[model samples]
Target: MNNQNSWKTLAVNLLAERTLLIVGIATVFTLLLLYPLFQMTPTLQASPNPPGEVFELQKDLNDKFPNSIHFTPFLLESLAGDVLTPNVLLEFKQRRQELFAKDAIGALAAGDLERQPYLVNYLDSETGVLMTGTHSILDPIEAGLIDIGTTLESASEEEVKLAVHRLISDPKTSAVLDFLSRHATHTPSTAMGHEIRLWVSPAMTFSVMTDNQKLGGGGLEIGVGGGPDVIAKEYLNRHIRDVMKEGSTSYAIWGIAIDANLEAQDEGKTAGIFIMFTVIGALLVVGLTLKSYWATAICGVGLGVLMIWLKGISSLIGLKSGLVIDLIVPIGMISLGVDFAVHALRRYKEELNKQYPPRMALKIGLSSVIGALILAMLTDSIAFLSNLSLHRSVIHFGSAAAMRFLLRSPF
Candidate 1:
């Protein structure tokens, strides 16, 4: 039974002498095990990080709007690059087929030379806005009947380019540009009287308060006397409002953002997490001082557990109370709580050190120091928790830390 001992009573008795050093080193190691969570630095005020602006924008968009397809910069560029391009490939295929059909030598080798048409390669490439089917009305084969018609048969590439441009200059494409705004950016640009409406997607996570903060979007209008575009912008504005009032925007956007935020098992949460740890630590404190499982159990078991939970809950509440907390903040808040619990235990140790022998010292310490120290913490906690009233996020941080200290107390 004696051999089953860990360090004997003497070693622990010696530890109680330089109790502060022991506690300090142990506290640091304990925190290191929880090092990841101790990230929430104590603060009386919360200063917003620059990136938090993204969250505010996300909230506003989500609570107000939904159903509108969230466009992203990459998606837009990829879509533009790939859309409506099948026809170009098809045209190239037909050109290749025409060349294969006209190869007289190959036709003869295949026993059909007599039926083959003369090899004539006609390539029409666009110089600018090329369209066709209406031209100078000269077919190379038909024009070859007259001497001047032969000139087109052997037309130079330059002549072909000119002819193609002449035919397509009045094609239907871009004809509407005259009516639409001339501010031609890939995403429309602002040309006075025309609003530049760029629908960047995954949606920006920051504030957008430009000089031209119009709540319109049908076609993005600006200028001295806005025309059709102004009407279009008004239409999109109402369209967006009607959609947002239904509360679909935030969910759609947050779903995408959650992919980028921290995960449940992420070690980074050590920055804000504190709990079972504080309980374990509190037990360690009682064990070292009381010198008996009976004393430690009486002080540290379920009661210590309750303290850990209560304080953890308080930290959690502060983190979740408002739009400001979000998921990242809880990690920092919990870490802050651990610091509080460690300090509380340290003070408890100081009181325990004053009396002789473990039992008498604990009794005297509890009777003398616990009440005053506890009452002080209670007063401090109330004042600390009141910090939640402040606008900055740090207020809840202070409250969470205070609550964590309350948990380790026997009360």
Candidate 2:
């Protein structure tokens, strides 16, 4: 049509005559892509005061418990009956307390009392000790009257069986016995009448102790002064490792810090593999579908440029890209650009087959697809923008999509 011809002429003239403006736009987009404007904070709430009652609750909790953030590592242990009796438990507790006291003293002397760590066990609180029924037997254990090794060595098989049964049945020792039994690889039996044998069992003493420490005390928990940094977590892990190595070989340690680091490493590797596969697959599909090297290159370049421009706009508008945004933006832009380009190219080929002049064919192609492209862009923009009230991340995604649509409209 004459109107389409006129519009094409105007677009050509603008590109040819307003070269500086085109260059400036390109330069601005380049700078925006290269230099990001906003700092990315990958948290549940990226905004300073994100909307929602959940955020309000989070604020209230933070205000109430200023020093509540910390990671606690579980110290697991397995000990033989001869090595982990009530008296041995008492000895281990005393040693742990002594070590904590020594560390506290050293930290205080060095004026690093802020770095002092605390250890907690079942006996740390009266409630915990009472719950485990350890309070009643604490006196006997402390007095060194319950020497399990000596008794087991001297007592008859029947006496040992009776003693074991009595210990397991009493409320005072039942919890500890049950814990050890549960984690034990082999169950004990009095059926072997000639010789008394004790099997190795996993103990819940450390677990219960750590839990009590975490719940009843404050400093033993890691990350108290805000979520722990890498260095802090590593230091805590090292400290735990050192304690386990020096104190007893019977215990094993599993820290959140180590587990988190391993998980992150695994995630990074998986992402890298996925990205490689995605790039290869996209290239193969686009190249095969277009069949023309130039067309494939143009589509690829256009998609990259579109993403860069959208990211720049996002930066300018104080929007930070999170994992979801990073994934959605590229795929969305590619789908939009590819659909437009493919349809327009097909129309151009059809016009050329009808014996139209090259320039006229291009103009006709643009005329055929421009309306549809605009409609698609408008629909997509409206759909995304309508989700603004759902979540702040959705708002960010919608804004970026709208901006990309606007930037692509000129072409």
Candidate 3:
């Protein structure tokens, strides 16, 4: 077999020229490893515009009302009670007044409320009707009774109960409660419980209402200037977490955006743990099965190179990796690299066992696998490229995988 002998001679000559292979490997590794240093951290944005008519409509809406859409975080506080009970209603009304006054002062001082944003109304008028308590519906003396403040000091428990019941059943009391429930964000926990809901404006004003209705008990809306995502994560979220940990259970504070980011971070940590496990398992299995330390090292190095290259390419292309990319790409690349490396190494061992020279064995191993690998990669590329019309993430992952396959072929 003169052709076989010629092939063996060529392989030997190539192997003898170790400098070329070393230089090529060094250049590839250096480029793959160093490129990441110049890259910025990836931002995760999931809701990029998709194709089709609905997306076009959304784009138009965004253009027409640039500042109309926003994510405003809300905090809810609730207190349990009968909506018409004098003392409970009084306390709730007083809390609202306190919050309103405090916000008014703060906004005025900050020049945010130079003109009153809300109208002055009967609630602010000098009505003898207290918004809460036994005398909430009528003046204490006008109701044919001693002043409630005086009665509470001397009245027996039964008398106090009777007074509260009388006040709750009053028509005037029903009117005031109806007004509040209509104007406020009201969600009743039970037949006896009433809730007040308020929107927190951009000026950090919050609504005052509370009851044990659901998780977080009640909600308060806060409209922070700048994006809610940024403010909630950087400032509001930290404060809320600290407040939650301080062992104060009187009220619960919930920030949906903040909670989501924290949960994502947790999932990322878990994914990292699994990735490390996968890498180690791959290395051990390859080393044992191939029975060659060199093969195992090559598999590990190939995977590392593929990951670095994917990240580098992502940066160069200005693609932000979303949750899907982060979850899929690393695992995908590792499995692909290991598969290629195992096939190559196994073929090399088979050639060696047939008593072929080392250089000839290496050449045959590479030649035997390259055609099948290229065919598989072509099919994979088609599948990935077909998805490009659907989402940006598909474009990113598909392109990255294609590049990684190209880069790993030489190894």
Candidate 4:
């Protein structure tokens, strides 16, 4: 009895008399801890890396070929017959014009066309945007048209056909045509001649790749504006996809960075909607159970603080959030938070019903459940922290979750 009374006195002193001190310390700690929030860069991967041998080999290859360059491919499939028809080619040409306009980021240019057909970097001096050049069948097609003394705009159907044929027959341009043909095959037609069939594929694809300019002492300059070139390229790729999709054609734009950004955007949108619904549900549940608006508001505020602390702790330790971690952590925290709040509130109400004063009731309610709450925190932390060695993503999730449990013990 004496021990229980002493425990109740401690709870009263800590929660009631020193509430302002606790709040001040938590606010300061959270502010300091949240420094890493601005610097966090989340990475989403399908799965962890392969075993050590394969992973190390891949890492070595990356180190050796650091400037090999990566490309984003934008595949365009015509819903309306051959992709090489005069009308379709003209439309595609127009789209390219929009994509590579002077006002835009620009496209790849050939440094020495006569010696070797290769792309060179084109940087916009005014915009500080570096556009990695693009490789497409259209490049060679345009060259063939120029060789034959006509452009896509002025060329008739016959002229365009001639340009495509010349593109295929020429040794200089044939390699580009062959590479394109591999990805976008000709439409099968028994009636059409073999030459005509070979030149009229229903699909074509283009790729864009940028070069990072080397700075003094082996430093690299990606672009101004913290990778404006990166941003411009993503915008450029998305624009290409949008243009391709305009006329009922099937389109897919993919690159390492592009796809990752797209997936992150999609997941972020989904997470927003999910969080909205979860908040609403939590609010409704807490409000209905507590039957007190103040209590519900407090619960809501507490949940928000818990989330901030969770994120702050994870950020401090340099953990990046993924889709799985984003989804799981909130659900667990909300459920546990609501459970803890409801139990303690109900216990306090019970003490009040017995005619205990508010202070005594608060003390008794908190003191009675403190042991159970601490035990729950320990067990949950252990369970989550146990996953530390499983995978990189698991490590992030586990550490964040364990931090959340520890944070809850104070509450």
TM-score of 3: 0.58
- Best-fitting candidate, measured by lDDT? 4
- For all candidates in order, the CA lDDT equals 0.35, 0.50, 0.48, 0.61
| Candidate 4 or 1, higher lDDT | 4
Stretches of candidate 1 exceeding 4 Å from the true structure? 1-67, 72-308, 311-360, 390-398
**Residue-by-residue lDDT tens digits, candidate 4, 1-411:** 678468656776689678789889877876775676555634332234324786567557645655444355666655565667667767766665554552243333221112221234444232233434555666566666787788888876666666676566665545556435354554333322334434667667666543322100112212211123344344544544554445443322333334444454467547757776787788899899879999899888787777777777676666766676667777777777788888888999899999999888888888888778878989999999988774565677788788778876654
Candidate 3 residue lDDT tens string, 311-364: 676676665555556666677667776887788789989999999998778777
Question: Cα-based RMSD of the predictions, in order?
Answer: 21.1, 8.1, 10.7, 7.7
Q: If scored against the real structure, what TM-score would every candidate get?
A: 0.30, 0.58, 0.58, 0.72
TM-score for predicted model 4 compared with the true structure: 0.72
Global lDDT of model 1: 0.35
* lDDT ranking of the models: 4, 2, 3, 1
- Top TM-score: which candidate number? 4
Supply candidate 1's per-residue lDDT for 266. 38
CA shift of 53, model 1, Å: 16
